[model samples]
Target: MVQNPERRTVLADAAIEVLARDGARGLTFRAVDREAGVPAGTASNYFANRNALLTQAAERIHVRLRPDDATIAAMARSRPAPSPEVLERELTAMYHRLAVQQIDYLALLELRLEAIRRPEIRAALTATMRANLEQNVAAHRESGLPGSDVDVVLMYLALSWLIIENLTLPGVLEGYDADRLIAALTDLVAGR
Candidate 1:
């Protein structure tokens, strides 16, 4: 069947919402359809089965979570030559914005965990994450951020863990302020 990109996107977004609220086992065409407020079987029309829905939902989460080009451009314009401090500020701001969207991140975490039980989903998610990492590295380079690709990769891993922990278990790092933590991360990435 011919796919409707717009409808598929809508269904996938609904699937993410379901996955976030109900985890992988709870995701179903009916649940997605309900979440989307579409008629019954609408999600099925877009996705062949649960796995396809899961994969599409994972892709949608990645797309929805990334910073837009305009935001990136504004950040790039903020500093002609991005210094360590500038990079730190930008990274902190970006992560803070992400922190506010806790549900989306929670859904992503759910998807990652779900992938562990499904090898096919795991492989697809790994590829998607690798692509995202590469794209982030290229964006950092283009914006003149102070980091090599390897540095960016490491920073990405650290930031991902930090964000996940901060969102999932608030006050776990009670002694450290967000800015101070981000500063340390910035210094680490900058090799200071």
Candidate 2:
């Protein structure tokens, strides 16, 4: 109901923090307000209800996780397509970014679980996720990136779990060298 876009985004970001910190059941307008350090009813003004807030929070997480324009431009500017070795560095760097952004990744994981119980949330997220993956695949094809579409998907799945373990339970991957693992993934992508 609030007309201020900035205020709404602030509330949405606060909602992400609440979702990550307390999970879905604990995400209330009051909780978001508390997290945002706003007045008791401020979140109510921005969000009609919990579902609206949750969807907005999911979108905000996507915005946060997306690579910036500069990064995108650089990827495009590599000229004549980067090599499979470059793909290794690219995927490794991407994994590092995801791992370091602990809160955003954890909040996204929370949303995925919540989606299982709430179809609306699933619907809201599915389109955005599908589009993103499509864009990734399209870009890989257009850029002539060394990996195939299947390779991209494989890296997506593999890196996601790697990041999850790195954030949620670092000990699980403690002894394995990250560089070697990324090299192996790259090898898989190159079909070598």
Candidate 3:
């Protein structure tokens, strides 16, 4: 069957919504169709099976949730060769934005959890995540951010964990200033 890219994208987007709201277990062809407000069997036509749908949803979440070019450009422009202070500021802003989009992050977390039991899904997610990390490393290099590839990877992991924790458990770390924390992290990652 000839694939319709637009229709596939729409279905995948709807699947992401369902995954975010209802989780992996709740994600079914019917649920996606209903979420998409499409007729029954529409999701089935686009995805061959549950795994395909899940994989597509994971891919869509990454695509839809990634920061736009403007934001990236702004970050790059924040500093010619970002010092620890500048890196901390950029990371703080990024974390705040992620907190604001908590649901999308939560959906990604759900995908990760689902992948734990499914090797194929795990492999797909791992590949996507590695590609994302490589892209981050490249961006850091191109933008002259302070850090080696390993440092960049470490920074990404730390920031992601901190963002997840902060979003999931609001006010849990109230005594500590996030900016200060990020500054310390930036210093550590940059080996300053």
Q: Can you give the TM-score per candidate against the true fold?
A: 0.93, 0.93, 0.89
Sliding window of 10 residues with minimal summed lDDT for model 2: 74-83
Q: For residues 46-112, what per-residue lDDT tens digits would candidate 1 score against the true structure?
A: 7777888888877778788888889867766666567897789887887788888877988899889
RMSD of candidates 1 onward, in order: 1.5, 1.6, 1.9
The CA lDDT at 179 in model 3 is: 73
TM-score of 2: 0.93
Candidate 3 residues lying further than 4 Å off, grouped into runs, are 74-78
Residue pairs in collision within model 3: none
Better of 2 and 3 by TM-score: 2
How far does residue 123 in candidate 3 sit from its true spot (Å)?
Answer: 1.6
lDDT of 2 at 177: 79
lDDT of all predictions, in order shown?
0.84, 0.84, 0.81
What tens-digit string does per-residue lDDT give for candidate 3 at 1-192? 329899899888888788878888899999989988989999998888999888877777767768998977775566655576677777888777777777678788888998999877787788888888888899778767677888888888888888888877868887877778888888887778
Ten-residue stretch with the least lDDT total in model 3: 75-84
- Stretches > 4 Å off in candidate 1: none
The residue pairs in collision within model 2 are none
